[model samples]
Target: MTHKIAILGASGYTGAELVRLIATHPSMEIVALAANSKAGMAYEDVFPHLRHLALPDLVKIEEIDFDNVDLVFCGLPHATSQSVIKALPKSVKVVDLSADFRLRDPEEYVKWYGGQHDALECQAEAVYGLTEFYRDDIKNARLVAGTGCNAATGQYALRPLIEAGVIDLDQIILDLKCAVSGAGRSLKENLLHAELSEGYHPYAIGGTHRHLGEFDQEFSAIAGRPVKVQFTPHLVPANRGILATVYVQGDAQAIYDTLQKTYADETFIQVLPFGKVPSTRHVRGSNFCHIGVSGDRIEGRAIVTAALDNLTKGSSGQALQNANLMLGEEENAGLMLAPCFP
Candidate 1:
């Protein structure tokens, strides 16, 4: 059964990525493309690389006919997706690529996002879209919230260890570097080419990054206690990908074994050979995540690094993967394309 899909914010990078990946999906078709600012323009006009595919012109979200759309990919901004998704037809399964429904608590939503969750009913029903760990939940969920790219990377390195009880709960530290594309296509004074190209610096230091809410929620749940890790995110010069280096107090071999065994049957997660670290270039533009582990100079400590495309596995591709499960289609059907190489 072919599923009809509508991308609610088609002019942005993640939305354009959804179009690019869905263009090859055997069971999905892009029936509607909505971008309020770019409404009425062909998708090709917004993303010239998509010029070859036959696609619909952008429309306003309010104008879409959900009766024909099986799935909706809401790639709007964090605060914007909540209301937009709440208005979508109930029968249409939604994979939101924003932060609207990621945190489970409404109070935490206001604390981190600075406003009350406008769609509390949907918030209660939305499933966190961390594909590997939440596969069963996502498979049956009608509303799935895609993770923050930085959150996804940090979790890849720490989740398995936390779940296995092989790492010290209080000592986890995540030092992550993300490409500019993760910031979205918005223009900002700090994101200017001149300001960003020549140097790299950390922002959201000292556990202030919004994604920490995700890390705290997920890790605390896994450990059956409050597990807060020291997390710092840095903006890098490149355009697409996130690399997280996680420091954990544990035996290196045990950490490696835990991750390898945990993801042994997963398709999109790759556990590299022990001591061999992964690079962002290896997983660029693909849904795959590569994890590598190595022993630290200090005994009882290990460093695990995870790499993935912020736009793909970190956002749109992950949205589609969850959509497939929600629709009962093959999980990796349209996501098997290999990563691009230099």
Candidate 2:
């Protein structure tokens, strides 16, 4: 049974990624592609690499016939998804790739996003879309809120340790390097080749990054206490991938064992050999997450690193993984392509 689909914000990086992955899906078909700003343009014109696939031309969201769409992948910008999703048909299961519904608390939503959530009812029922941790909830959800790419990378490294009590929650620190694509397809002075190619610097330092809200919400929930991780994110010159190096006070071997056991049955998460480390290059353009653990030179300390394609495992690919569960399809369907390694 092939499921009909529609993609909103289809001209963006994550939107194009959803199209790329779904192009080869066995049981899903793209029926509509909506990008209000680029309405009436050929999808190929916007993303030349995808010219090979015969995709629907970009159209305005209001032009789409939702009755024909079984699922809608909402990749609209932050705060935009709420109003748009609120008006969609109740029968259309939604996997929102925006920041609007990710925070469960309405106040937290306002605190980080700078506005009150307009779609409170939808936000109230939307399941968190961290596929591994929220699989059961996603399987039965009508709306699944996709996680922040940086937040996703950090969680894959720390969640197990926090849950197993293998780390000192108070001493947790996450330093992440993210590719520019995670910023979306927008043009900016800093992202230009003249400026970005040779240098990398941190933004959202001192726990100011919005994804910290996610870390606080998820980590605190798992530890049964308020777990605040000191998180800082840096923008690299690369076009894809995220690498999160987490510092924790714990038994190195025990932390490694916890991650290995937690992801033993997970199809997309790979826990590397202890004392080894992961690189963004290894998991680029794939739905896989590679995690590595090593003991710090200082006793009682450990370093856990996780790498994944921000546009894939961190966003669109993660969205599809949740969609598979929601639609009753095999969770790994359309998501098993191997990483693009050099």
Instruction: Say which candidate scores most in lDDT.
Output: 2
Task: Supply the global lDDT for candidate 1.
Answer: 0.93
lDDT of 1 by residue, 65-122 (tens): 9999999999999889998888887998999999999999898888898988999999
Query: TM-score per candidate, in order?
Result: 0.99, 0.99
**Model 2 stretches with alpha carbons more than 4 Å out:** none
Candidate 1 off by > 4 Å: none
Q: What is the C-alpha RMSD of each candidate to the true structure, in Å?
A: 0.7, 0.7
How high is the lDDT of residue 50 in model 2?
Answer: 96
Per-residue error for 166 in candidate 1, Å, reads 0.6
RMSD of 1: 0.7
